[model samples]
Target chain A: MVGPVFTWIAEHPKVFWTAAQQHLVLSAAALGLALALALPLAVVLLRWRRAAATAIALVNVLRTIPSLALLVVMLPILGTGFQPALVALTLYGLPAILINAYTALSEVDADIVEAATGQGLSRAQIVRRIQVPLALPVIFAGIRTAAVQIVSAATLAAFIGGGGLGELITAGMGTLDIPQLVVGGLAVAALAILTELAFGLAERRLNRTRHA
Target chain B: MNWTLANYDRLFTALAEHVGLVATALAISLAIALPLGVVSARRPWAYAGVMAVTGVLYTIPALALFALLIPFMGLGTAPAVTALVLYSLLILVRNVATGLREIPHEILEAADGMGYGAWRRLVRIELPLALPVIVAGIRITVVTQISVATVAAYISAGGLGDIIFQGITQDFGEKVVAGAVVTAALAVVADESLRVLERRLRAAQSERA
Candidate 1:
């Protein structure tokens, strides 16, 4: 299994690299889009207590649609390739980021917010200087979780011709090439771990900055 | 464009099937994960190794994992159950370990002082205290599995994904939406129920503590 994996990598270096890049692009684009929508929505939802439950419930629901089904469902509307993959991954990523942002902001110590207000900080200043900074760790945690999940989920992109390492796994399955399957599986596992480590380092840096 | 009671019945039936799959997968996961978690937690080296292995498993993409299993399991519920259980081990084991470790040393000492043996302490004391966090871990696993299990449709496992996949095959939007709607609703209900149970357990434990 290991032998074939190395051989495949050596023989098809360009193919592997292209697939890897596509995988990264899909995951990053989806996560980025989700973050762009989720952050503001989280903020707005947090402000309107009445809407918080409904908003959270909606995202929770969105989160539950499996990525495979989501991709297939979106294929009709968005067609195949990256768009459907992006849409599916984006929806899959939203709940964690949205909930994390909402909870982290809401969890900001009320006393501290009150103190900041008492010190004559404007509401915007309080939110910008205090709440966001305070909530940064938890929010980043959400982002980290979403990023890892998206990286893993992006493999399904291949199922709909979105093209990723999943192609390797799918193809390997077709031929009963255990080595190829292992290579694809290990590559995906490696990618997820590497992305997680990168985010973990970033999280540590953010925490250090917060403390400093 | 005709909305009718029949449509509602189909929707309900679809939801029932989806929830059934989710429930079965979660139950299987719990059955496997809980004992392994407990045994591993009692043995430090074993616990470390189990955690590391499962942590690696946790990162595997659901589709790939299911696809990989197809050679041996040959698709459907067996592969789906196997994949879901494997995906669940990391969360379940870690939470069980954390819960066990978080049990106050003083409490353990008190149990020991009360002449409670290891088995008695673990059964009568440790297990109860760990229930809250363990339940939380289960909640996460169940909810995650509920969503991920939808992918099992690709392998002919048959659930709400049947409708979704059928919609994709035939280019019908309503079926796709119907599948998604049911899946989402099942997740919400299951997640909220588990959360409520977790909270109730935690409150009871706190009152006792």
Candidate 2:
């Protein structure tokens, strides 16, 4: 099964590469959109104590919706292909990122925040220079989780006619093409591991830089 | 779009089925994870290998994993349970290992010095001390499993996902929202309950200490 996949990859390098690009694009777009929305949502939710529970509840609801179902739900409003897939994936990613971000920011040492305030650091400066840096590791972990999840969920994009390696797996399933299925599965698995390692390294580097 | 008692009853039944599947899967995962975690903790090399294997398993996408297993297991409860169990292992094992490792070294040394056997130390000392973290991991695993298990509906393992999947096929917003609402409620209930359990376990551990 693996042999045929390698042979096919060798013969059609461009096709495999193109699929990989599409997969990355989908994952990246979803994750990027999620981070952009979730960070501010986290900040605002944290600041407004009364709104925190409601915000968390909304995210919880969004997160629990099955990704495929969410995609389908979006299809009616957004139409199919990448747009609906991206919307669903972003919605899926937001809860984790938001919760982690909120936790990380709120968990910042109150004394340190107070000290910064005492030094006449503006609220924005304190948030940017102290809270954000202090919260980076946890926020990054959330991003890592979101990244892995988005990458994997992007495979389902094919079900909505959004092109990616999912197309291969879905097609292979229909025809019982073991090589295609295995390749698609293995490729996604490998990509996930690579993403984990890359993020893990980046996390370590950031921690080191922070300490230094 | 008119609300009906039949639809309400069907929704409740689906919610019950989904909860049942999640509970069954979590119980099985805990049963396996607790023992394996303890044994692996005692053996460093085995612990590393087990963590690596489970970690790798965790990265496999839920959809792909389910699709891959369909041929061997056929699409139904069996495959769904198997996949959920595999998914739980990474979190459970890692948490168990961390909890075990975090036990003060001096305490273990004292247990050995007092001539406590390996099994006695593990049973009477390490396991109790590690229970809190283990429960925390289980909480996370259970919450995650509840959310993901909805995907099993795709393979004909009936649950709240049935509503969502049906809604998808029929383009019915109400059905989709119904399923989503139930699942979210389930997640919150499971999470809060486990959190309570985790706190109780921690309190007990502290009392024991």
Candidate 3:
């Protein structure tokens, strides 16, 4: 099994490399979009109880929709390929990132926020200087979780022509090519593990800094 | 292109298959995770390793995992169940261990004072107290398994995903919609039902002296 996969890798190094890059790009785009929106939105929304509750409820509903269904749902609206693929993966990632950031920010000590306010910090300053730093560890944990999830979910993008290692797996399945299946599966799984470990380390480092 | 009564049998079969796939995966996962969780609770060192390994496994994408399994497990139920059971271990283990650990020391002391032996205390008091949290974990595992089980259809494991995959391939918008609606409904119903069980456990927990 291992020998065949290795030989396949040796024979088609470029194919594997390109697929890996596409997978990374897809994951990164999804992760980046999710964080860019979820982080600030989490902080802002938490200030309004009704909005936060509504947003979170909607996200929960969205999260339960199977990614395949979601990708197909996107097909009519976005017409497949990169845009729909990114949208689907980003949606897959939102709940973890948004909920985590919101929960972390909500958990920031109220007294600490009050003190920062009394010290003449603006609301934004209190958020920036006080709320955010304290929320980093939790938010980082959420980001890590979201990142790994996005990487995994992005593999489905292959079904939608999203371009990635998923393409390899999808092609393998289409052609009944076992070697392609083995190489593609291993690559994506390795990517997920590496993402988890990398984020896990970052989380530990952030935690140490927070403690120190 | 359109939904018809003719498809009902297929849809129902897919739903049943999906349910069976989830049930099998959760049962297998629970069997391994419960004991492992207890040992980890007793041995703090084991907790980290167990958590890290399961956590990594949990992150593996379902399709990729099916890919990895195909060489050994082959297509259909075997690979699907193995991948899903692996995915479920992390959450279930954490929940059981946390539930066990969070049992207050006072309660255990009281159990001991009542002449409750280790096994008796575990079966009678500790497990009952931990039941709610463990159920909460099971709820998460089930809902996720339901969702993940759809993807297993891609590997010909036979589930709601069969409808989903076929709909997409056939460009049958109605098939896609029907499949998505049922899959979503399954997740929501399973999630809410387990929630009731979870709440009932909580009510029982709170009633305990």
- Give lDDT per model, in order: 0.82, 0.82, 0.87
Which stretches of model 3 miss by more than 4 angstroms? Answer: B1-6
Task: Give the top-scoring candidate (DockQ).
Answer: 3
Better of 1 and 2 by lDDT: 2
What fraction of the true interface contacts does model 2 reproduce? 0.28
* TM-score of each prediction: 0.84, 0.84, 0.95
Model 3, B1-209: lDDT tens digits are 33736688888988999999999898899989999988897788899999988887887888888988887877889889998899899989899899999999998999999999998998898877889999999998998798789899998899998887887898877787788788888998898799899998898768875
RMSD to the hidden true structure, all candidates: 3.5, 3.4, 1.8
Which regions of candidate 2 deviate over 4 angstroms?
A7-19, A43-79, B1-17, B70-74, B102-121, B124-126, B171-173, B204-209
Q: What DockQ values do the models have? A: 0.45, 0.36, 0.70
Winner by TM-score: 3
lDDT of 1 by residue, A1-212 (tens): 56777998998898788888889889989999999999988877767998899888777767765666667666657777778888888988988999999999999999999999899999878878999988999999999999998998898888677888887777776787777776777788788889888999999999998798
The alpha-carbon lDDT assigned to residue B130 of candidate 3 equals: 88
Worst 10 residues of 3 chain B by lDDT: B1-10
Chain A only: give the TM-score of model 1: 0.94
Query: Model 3 - which docking category?
Result: medium
Task: For candidate 2, give the lDDT.
Answer: 0.82
